[model samples]
Structures are given as C-alpha cells and as structure tokens.
Target chain A: MNVFKLNSWSPYVAGGMVGILICLSVLITGKYFGASTTFVRSAGLIEKVFAPERVEKMDYFVKKKVRIDWQWMFVVGVFFGSLLSSRISGDYRKTALPPMWETRFGPNRARRWVIAFVGGIIAMFGARMAGG
Target chain B: MNLLFWGLVTGIFFGFLLQKGQVLRYDKQLGALRLSDFTIVKFMLSTVIVAMVGIYFLHDFGLVALKPKTTALGANIIGGLIFGAGWGLLGYCPATAVGALGEGRWDSLFGIIGMLFGAAIYAEVYPALKTNVLAWGNLGKITLPGVLGINHWIVIVVLIIAFCSLFYWFEKKGV
Candidate 1:
C-alpha cells in the first residue's frame, strides 16, 4: 500500500493501469491511445500564432484544429510532475547536448537538433501514413 | 468543458503512471534499443494486451465504436522504415521525449521540435499520401479476428497467454 509513495511502481502495475486508461480513453473520447497527433496539433497551434493563414490553408490543420486536448495536457502533466520530482531530488541540471548523443552525433547542438527534428517528422509521418 | 475537465484529470493520472513506470528514464529507453532492458517492452505489451481486450469487448457490447485504421502494407513498411531511422537518430520515441524533457533532461527538446516541423509537413502532404503510400495494401479496418475469421476473445486469450509466457521468461532472465 505504501508502495504508492515510492518513486517507481512495478512495471506490471503501471502497465496494467495504462491499459485501463486506454479503455477509458476510448470510452470517453471514442479514440484509442494516441500520442503522435498531439505533435501535429502543436504544429497548428504554433503556426497559427506565426502565420494564421498557413494553418487555415493546410487541410490537416483545418480538420484537426489547434486547440489543447487530452493528450497535450497529458504530456504537460508528465512534464510538470517530472519537474517537481527532479527539483525535489535536486537532479535537475540542464544538458544542452546529452553525452550519449554527442558520443555518436558529435558535440554539435545544431546537428543533434537537426537529427531530432528529422526523427520526429519521420516518426510522426510514418505513424500517420502507415496507420501505426 | 466537462470533457476537457475530465481530460485534465486523465492527463494527470496518465502522466503519473508513465513517471512511475520509469519508462521515462534515459537509460531505460536506451536499454530498450539495446535489447538489454525489458522494462519498456513489459510496460507496452501489458498496455497493448489489456487495451485490446478491453476495447474489443467494449466495442462488441456496443459501448463504443471500433475505429480501426486501414492496413496499408506499403505505407506500413516504408513509413515504418523511415520512422525507425528517425527514431534511431533521435534516440527516443515521441512520448518518451516529452517525458524526458519533463524530467529535466531537456535534451529531448530537439525531437519535440522535429515533431512540430514534421507534423506541419505531414499535414500538407496528407491528401497526396492517401492516393499514394497510404493507398497501398488498403485492408479496410480489419482486425486479427476479422482476418482469421474467429472470435476475438479466442485471439485475445491466446495473446494473453503468449504475453504472459514472455513475461515469465523475462522475469526468469532477470530483465
């Protein structure tokens, strides 16, 4: 019972809960578990701020809209919760380039960002086109 | 606003579970790629199986509509390859990237930015994709039971058994 106070839960427990959440998500929203679309919505949100015309012109944006939704808030919550814990544990140092990325991609922040950006596009694009 | 309110509550719980699952840890994600850690696999597999059973049953009972996406083999293969390449380069999937950033790693911001740009591009090209890559294989909203022409419950039970066995092995191997 006190295990609820622990930093991490057993994978089974957490995973099971996520599964139940999936069911609830479908029941409540009529959608299964989705995360990729949030990025697209964010794109619309950002673009509308900069170029409202471009967002209006894009068919996908026109259909999906740019409002904050469940998954977006879910991601935000994930972030704030982590921020709170990391702050409490005093483990919140910022790294411009993680050494792991540097050892492979080299010490260039720009290059890393480029690859990451490309990766996000590829992943989301594939997920969309492939129906994954 | 009611739906949105529930959404906020759901997000808090969802985020809490993700954090507690420890799948947000950099080393755990890296290990998953390396095939050394089964934490992500365990978590995701469990999530999938449970969702499959729950959603399917709910749909069967007419409690919800099953909005299964079409099965486009060409799009799947090509898109998956492209996605894999990007994921390999980025070092974390989209969800984990957000979670990692929240954990104060901040290194995942690049992937998030990439997602924004990628999503923007995807929106513009989506209509064309319908006729091209997305049209390939065109199996209209078919499920495993639909393909095999059997009861979904049967398939679900078999999958659960299979997953449980895999879980047992992982535990024995001390993953």
Candidate 2:
C-alpha cells in the first residue's frame, strides 16, 4: 500500500459504515440524507429575509423548506467535521493546487477560480434539473 | 431527531469515508467515470441495499410508518442521468461534495458552491417550470418489489445477492 499516496478507508468498509449511519438517519430522523436541501433552505431563508415575495413565489422554495436553524447548522457541521478529521489524520494541506495539478495546470490561480465558479453554476443547474 | 442534525452527522460520516477511501483525489473519481474502477458502483449499491433493507424492516415491524410513495419514474430517470453527469464532470455528488469539503479538497468547495447555486437558481425559476418540468409525469415513490409484484423481502434479498455477485465479479476481474 502506498502510505504516501493519501489516507483513504476501504471502500466496502466505508460504504457499510455509511450505510449503517444512513440507516440510523432514517430511524431517528424520518428523513433520507440529502445535502442539496440544506443549501436550498439556506437560500430560501436569505430570500425570505430580503425578498420574501420571490421566495414565496418560487415553486421549489415554497414546499418542504427547512428553517435556517437546522439547515445552516448542518452545513457547518460538515465543514467542522472535515476540518477535524484532516487535523487528526495529518493529511491536511492548504495548497490550492496539488503538485501534479500545478505541473499540468501551470499554477494559474485565476483559471482555477473561474473554472470553479463556472463548474459550480453548471453543476448546480444540473442537480436542480435532476430534481436534486 | 431533526433532519438538520441527522444531515450533519451524515455529512461528517460521508466526509470521513471519502477521505478514507482516497476518493477526494480527483484521479480516483475520474477513474470511476472511465469505468476502470468499480469503487463508486460498489459503494452506491451497498448504500442502497443497506437503506432498502433497513427501511423495509423498520416499516415492517411497525417501528416506522412506511410511506412508500410511488416512484416518479420520469423524474428519477432524468434526475439520475443529470446527477450522473455531474458526478462525472465535477467528481462529487451532493453528499460526497460535502464529504470532499470535509476532507479539505478545494475543488469540492467549488462543487458545493455550484450545487447551492444550482439549487437556488432552480428555486428562483421554479414557477415557470412547475407545470412542464415538475408535473411532466408521476410514477410516485415506487420501489423495486412494488413494481415487480414480488414480496418486498424477496426483492431485497435478490438485490443483495445480485450486488454481491457483481462485487465478486468485479473483484475477480480486478476492475
């Protein structure tokens, strides 16, 4: 095994573990796990505060929307959990581009930033079109 | 018990696993897209099986209400296709995107932002698309066994066996 490659748990083991966690989610929360909903709810809350009419009028935001309290907290937890894990595992690195990527992509921060933004838009649109 | 709390826990677990699986690496995801690796398929199948079995048993024992809604086939197919495309292009699904962020992959941050933007845009334009896109069809929460006219447990068992078989084959083929 390449210890220097990166830290990764076995896929089967990780899948089974996540599967059990999802089972717990269903049992305790009565909801299937989803990440998109949180983002939508947060956006709704933003709209609700600044542009109530728009949020209310939007078909996607009008139904089954979560309040800010729960949705934002959940997103925050994701960030924190990841940060903690990286810290403990000694795998945390702050470089924007990996070494191999730097060689291939030429360390063009501007290009990376633009790609990231456009990619975000395309991905988001695609996800929504897919019923998220 | 709240959706948010559970979502958080799920997010953490997802991130941990992604890191552990080395899936945060862009190359691994690209490999899966190229069909050279079965890691993603195996992971997804196992997840569905676990969820299906767990939900079935929970509902069966009256521990939870089985609100088995009809599966919206059109939506599912279209949604799945788009989702798969996004998975291929961005190398992260909604859940795994969060996991990627957790593992400190900067690209995942873009993916997450894109997901949020896409969702928000959908919300903004939902009214215009409601009649056509949203109401195009309705299969209504249909499950595998429900459509097949077989016992639910049998369906679950068969699916598990099939998945295991596929896993076995993949392992043997070393793909």
Candidate 3:
C-alpha cells in the first residue's frame, strides 16, 4: 500500500512505528524521541542573534547552548514531513483559529494568542521541571 | 556524515506517523482532553509500551546506559499541572504546534512563540527551582521496576496487559 496516499493510518500502526522510533532514536543518535528541547534551544538561538549579551546571561542558554543540533533538525524534519503528508493527502487547511476554540473560548484572536502563549509558558516550564 | 542527518530522518518518520495518526487535528486533541475520543491515548500508550520494551532490552544488552532522571514528586506534580494547563489552553503541545503549522494551521504560531519565551523564563528560574520545587520528593534516579525490585520486563508485561485491556474496553464503549 502507498501509505503516503492514504488520508490516515490506523492509530495502532502509527503508535507501533513511533515506538520503534524511540528505540532507533537512542540507538542511532543516543537521544530519545522528544521535541521540547528543540523549542528551548531554538529560543536560545533566536536570542543569540538579537541580544548576545542577554543570551550569555541566561542560565538555561548557558546550559543548553544554542546550536542547530540533531534535535533541532529533527523538528525541522517533522515540519517538512507533515507538510509533505498534508500536501500529498490534500488534508491541509489554513486557518487562524479552530472552531472549537472560538466556541469554547470566544472569538477574539488576541485573546486566543494570549491564552496560547500562556499555555506555552506553562507547558515548557512543566516539561523542563519534569526533565525532558 | 552529519550527526543531524539521522535525527532528521527519525523526525521525518515521527512526523509522518503523527500526521497519519490524525492526532494533529485540533478537534482530536480537544477530544482527548474532554474524554470524548480515545485515539490519542491509545496511540501514545502504544508508543510508551513499545519504547519501554525496546529501551530496557537495549539497556540489558549493554548497548546504551539507562539514564533515568530522578523521580521527584514535586517536579512531576507541579510541572504536570503547569504542562496540562498550557496544553489545554493552546490545544497544541510543542510537537503538535509544529505539526499543526505544517498542516497550515497558522494559529499554532502563537504557541510556538509562547513556548520559546517559556523556555527563557524557565532558564531564569532554574537555580531557584533546583533547590526548591525540583528538590521536593527527590527519589533519586529510579524506575517503577527498580523501585519494586523486580525485572523491568515483568512490569512491562503487566503494563501491556493492562493497556490492552483498557483499549479493549474503549473499543467496547465505542470511544
């Protein structure tokens, strides 16, 4: 079967593949299948360009160090892969906000951004504190 | 060979899997949180079980050292609460945010930017958290099997059975 042409794969098969990925991730690159660190390091990389002094001062950046490492490229690859899938399967839809969010949270784009931003902060902090 | 090539490949496959699994949908994410859909849970649980078996097997063979982080109750509890809050609010976790973007959902951009700042903020407070919240209930590096003083496979088997049962129940319930 041309998996790429299909609109979706059974969750079970996808899950199984993702599981093997966790193992392959370690075996090939000595890293686990995770995406949070890429966001963190990318933050540092962005800051380093604009405010080198601030980047140096930030303890997290000092520890994590800003570089396009394997994880970073992995995330980059994720973006392209999904883009490819959506493009192939014709499931891509551009939207500023989902209907559910608007219905539940209301229709203010600014409000949505604020909430999403706050959510990001909380999620990242939680992920870091919990270790990866 | 570039060290990143393998990671990129891994990520590409992972992305494809996530997309194919249809977990990238906002409604699916919201549904998972609302208990209206079991798709996300099954997918993630399967991955967890699979990884559990594979990682431990590889470790047993001495191919890789198992580096389990400390089981800090405080960090886990507080961090989990905070994480859930963000995830619920944004309807997109870090990985999903990227995938949503790839699927042409522009709103996930807010989450992407927000998380970047969140990381910065976490860095600023790391020192304080290290001595305080992060130190709470620090149990050292340990796993469930290790804590139980049993073979890892035993725990893995039990978890697999339990999860399979749960999946069966979900199917029965039409979830």
Candidate 4:
C-alpha cells in the first residue's frame, strides 16, 4: 500500500495510535495531551509582553507560568508533524477554506474568519473556566 | 531537555494520529457536533477507553502515577457548554485547529487567533471570576474510583461498556 496519499485512514487505527500515545505521554511526562492550556499559556506570554507586572500578578499566569514548557513544544510539534504528515501523504494544500465550509457559508473568507475567531474565543473561555 | 524531547516525540505521534483519524477535518467535526457523522466521536471514545484501561493497569503495576485533575462542576458545565457551542460553529477544537493549520488549511488560523484572544479574556477576568463562578462546586481531585471506593479497573470496564454501547448505536444509526 502506498504510504503517501490524500485519503483518511480508519478511525479505529488512528484511535489505537492515540491510545498508545496517551499511555506513553503519561509514563513520560505525567500529564495529559491537551492543546487549550498551551493556547492559554501563549496568551499569558503575549500579555506579559504588554503588561509584565499585571500578567505576573494574575493567578492563572502565576500558577501555570508564562514560559515555554513541554506543552508549548508539544503544540509546535503537532503543527509541524501535521505538516509533515500532509506532505508525506501528498495531501498538502494551501486552501483558505474547505469545501464543506464553502457550501454552508457561501465561499466568503471573511465570514469563515469571523466565525472561527468568535468560536475560538468562546471555546477557549469555556476550556479555561473548566480547567480543560 | 529529556522531558522536552519526550513531549515533542509523543506530540508528533499524537498529531499524526489526529490527522489520520480525520479529526482535523471541518466536516467531520461539524458532523460530530450535528450528530451526523460519528467518526470523530468513535475515535475519541475508543481513545479514551484504551487510554483509561492502559493507564489504570500501569498505575496498578506501579509503572505510572495517576494525576487526575479536580472535577470542577461549575467550570465543567459552563466550559463544556461554551466549548460545544464553539465546536459546532467553528468545527475545530484547540487540538484540531492547529492540526488543520498544519495541513495547510489557512482558515484554521482564525480559530487559533480566537483561542489566544479567548484565553487572554479569561486571564483578564480571572481576578473576579475566580472568586465567584470559577470556584463554584469545586470537587477536588476526585475520580470515579476514589468517589465510589472501587477499583479503577471497574470504572474502566464500565466506561468501556458504556462507550461501546454508544458506538454500537452510532453504527446502527449510521450517523
């Protein structure tokens, strides 16, 4: 079978791999794999650039620390890894919007941006509030 | 350096799996939210079940330590609702957003930017929110096993059964 193609794999296979990764992650780092925390941490780092004093005073920042930790690197790895996977699979494309989105939202780049941004904001807010 | 290396390695594998599983696809995510496609749901459920079983077994064998986070009821309910809403709208969670970006879906950038903004907003309001809403119903570091005083394996079994039943229904419904 060709290892490089623009097609999806079985969900069961992917999930199995993820399961192994989770177990390994815990064994290696005693933490779960999550992306929201990294985003929140990045926000803290950015806010620190503007208001170092205030950001430091914030309890969340103080507790989590606005530094590039393992999770930060993990997220970076994810981005690059995905890029690598797409390249290897020959599925890499520079599309602004996917077809599904175009059909539902009428092919407007600005609309996609707005919806994604607002949705991201809402999702992150909930994630942080819930300690996700 | 060792820890960082391990994190990167594990994350790469996880990211690969996510991309392979089609979790980064906007359609799959939106479909899962709409109850139209069960691909993402099945992937996530199976992941949870497998991880849970392996985790507790490892813990039992004294190979790993279990550090479950506190179950903050208020935070969970509020955050879950908002997260679900956002997932429906953007068809991207924090994990899938970056994965999609890596796949060269430039629209994913907006969601990432929004997530950063959202986190900043949460930080800005933390001083007030922490004392009131965020701290509500704080069930500290409680797990199902701990709460029921049962073996972790039992909880894992139950979760597997429940998830499998759901998966069967999803298959039957063809959604």
The DockQ figures for the candidates are 0.58, 0.48, 0.73, 0.78
lDDT of 1 at A117: 72
- Tell me the deviation in Å of residue A87 in model 1: 6.1
lDDT (10s digit) by residue, model 4, range B66-135: 8788887888898889888877777788888988999888888999999999998888788888788878
How far off is residue B11 in model 2, in Å? 3.4
lDDT digits (tens) for residues A11-130 of candidate 1: 888888989997997798765556777888888998899999878887788777788887677667666665554554455567677655667667877887777777777777776665
Q: Over the stretch A17-98, how does candidate 3's per-residue lDDT look in tens digits?
A: 8999888888767887678888779888877888999888877777887788888888888888888888889888787888
Question: Residues B113-134, candidate 3, lDDT per residue (tens digit)?
Answer: 9898888888878878878898
What digit string (tens of lDDT, one per residue) describes model 1 on residues B19-99?
678787656776778888889889999988888888888988899888877777888898888777777777777777877
Which ten residues in a row are the worst by lDDT in model 3 chain B? B1-10
| Candidate number achieving the greatest TM-score relative to the actual structure | 4
Task: Highest DockQ: give the candidate number.
Answer: 4
Please list the C-alpha lDDT of all candidates, in the order they appear: 0.77, 0.67, 0.85, 0.84
Question: Candidate 4 has which clashing residue pairs, if any?
Answer: none
lDDT of 1 at A47: 84
Candidate 4: Cα lDDT at B8: 81
Could you give me the TM-score of model 2 versus the true structure? 0.84
Local error of candidate 3 at B31, Å? 1.1
TM-score of 3: 0.94
Compute the lDDT for candidate 2.
0.67
Give the lowest summed-lDDT range of ten residues in model 1 chain A: A83-92
